[model samples]
Target: MSPEEAPARRRGRPTGSRAGAPETREAILAAARSEFAARGYAKASIRGIARTAGVDPALVHHHFGTKEKLFGAALEFTFAPALVVPEILEGGPEGVGERLARRFLSTWEVPEVRERLIAVMRSALTEDAAAAMLREFVSRELLLRIAAQLDVPEPHLRAELAASHMVGMAVLRYVLQVEPLASADPEELVGLVAPALQRYLTER
Candidate 1:
């Protein structure tokens, strides 16, 4: 080969070089998030995520192990609720409504979280197992924790109501993208919604 050709020779595995592994993983995660958000858990495919990421389908399996694990990671990264929710509830029951509303709205406004939530909700509507998983997470992690902290007699009922209110608003604003509601100021929403939430937590 010519000297110029020799100097230009590729140095390592075409795509699997050690230096490229982290980049590949990030690409796969970004593509997987988009796929899961658009397709829902039941319809999203590892092959499709791999195709979008421009990697071998086997690479997706190698990275994430299984579709369920991928979905969990994608959702966790997208929503990041485990980090936010507890912080929101940290101020105790008196501040719960405002804190919850602010945090929920802020979290949902994130593009990835909004998309992931819509995907999860869609999956919950159509797939029983998906719905159960969603319910279990919300119930065990969110509602129950908040309920236990409250002084109300029907803490569970109040928690459910609060959850319903937040979920309903999310569906309308994020998923449906309904005009004014979709574009409404976050503070305005907090003002409007927090009272109802506060009442649920405090009232008989």
Candidate 2:
């Protein structure tokens, strides 16, 4: 083949070594995060993420399997809220409030969590599907687990209210960037907030 044809052929494939699967996967995830944040799960298209990532759409399919799975991974990477909550609840009912507050504050302090929270909040507000997805995750994974552990009469309602409190605080502090509240120290915020959370979890 001529030199010109050879260069064009080489450029057709990804540059660098063929062992760039990991890098490609990371790129797709980064792009997926942005796309999902902007368009949300309902409107976000895999083709768009692939275009943003500078990879073939097939590669995205190969890596993530489907848009829903990709969205789940992106959400997991962003928030990780579901990870620590169970452990906090397991610690004992008495300290549940303080533990919940501490975990919430600490998680929000991370930039990615803040971004993810904002994205989810925006999607929840604007898209019916996104809102449903958020509600399902909160109810099925987060609240139900805590409700089963607690002795509250209306555990579902209490768990929901607790979620609202946490989500509201997140909206105010991270998304709205409200003064004093956003800048407040984690320990101080926990001290102020834990009692409310505890009451929600433990009160009859």
Local error of candidate 2 at 173, Å?
Answer: 1.3
TM-score against truth, every candidate: 0.79, 0.82
Model 2: residues with Cα > 4 Å off, grouped in runs: 1-23, 39-43, 65-69
Q: Which residue pairs overlap in candidate 1's backbone?
A: none
Ten-residue region with minimum lDDT total, candidate 2: 11-20
Taking the tens digit of each residue's C-alpha lDDT, what string does model 2 give over 1-204? 678557645766453232256888889988988887888777889999988988878778888898877876676666566667777888888979998888888887888767777777787788776677667777777777778888888988987888789888888888887998988888998999899999998878
Please report how far candidate 1 places residue 162 from its true position, in Å.
0.8
Clashes of each: 0, 0
Task: Name the TM-score of candidate 1.
Answer: 0.79
Clash pairs, candidate 2, are: none
Model 1 lDDT-worst window of ten: 11-20
lDDT (Cα, tens digit) per residue for candidate 1, span 2-111:
67545424542234432247888888888887886677777889989988988777777788898877776665565557456556656777867888898889888877
